[model samples]
Target: MVKRQAYQPILITDASRSQHDQLRSRQLRYIVMMSIRAACLVVGAILVGVKPPLLWLWLSLCGVGMVLIPWLAVLLANDGPPKEKYRLANRLHRSQRDETPPRSLPAEERPHPVIDAEQ
Candidate 1:
């Protein structure tokens, strides 16, 4: 029995990527939080005049969501690309056109093809 190889991960290494991606993600988070805050504030204002019982809980959740936005942004920003992808792609592209052909599956085996039960 032959063991199959695992697929490699992608790499991302543009210097500005980390900075720009972080900044953009943070900006998006801030915008979303601010919009939600404004919405809740408006609702609270309208409800305050009539004394809605659920206003306190609604305002509390919005406040907490506003406070957590930046932390969430940071988490989103930290998931950038790995460092090995560019090198691997280059190696694959080079190997494809080189004098030596790309590697082949073992000669003794043929891969299975899927069949549709309906057919």
Candidate 2:
């Protein structure tokens, strides 16, 4: 008698986001960050003209925002989704399995037929 394996249901939660969706999200994030940087520049210019009480502090904050936003935005835009735990585990398991020495059959165990060279 043969034993049957249990059935497993496919779960939608296991699926990763599509490339197009991921790209769109990243693009939106980058745009928002750049917009913030532009706002910082405008605020800095306004601060320069108005000369507020804490003029130096406000200008320094805006300058920092303008300088940092682009660097962070670029880094985030280029970043890809992290590998799933099961995916990493499977890769490691596969590599380890491949590295194991292959078994070889003894001469007698290997199939061979006599070759007649004098025929």
| TM-scores for all predictions | 0.37, 0.69
Q: Please write out the lDDT profile of model 1 over residues 45-81, one tens digit for every residue.
A: 6667877678788767756765675566556555554
Error of 1 at 19 (Å): 3.2
Q: Worst ten-residue run, lDDT, model 2?
A: 110-119
Error of 2 at 35 (Å): 0.4
| Cα lDDT computed for each candidate against the true fold | 0.55, 0.75
lDDT of 2 at 83: 56
- What tens digits encode model 2's per-residue C-alpha lDDT throughout 1-119? 89863333333443557789999999999999999999999999998999989999999999999999999999999998765665667646765665423236444333232322222
What's model 1's lDDT at 42?
72
What total of clashing residue pairs does each candidate reach? 1, 0
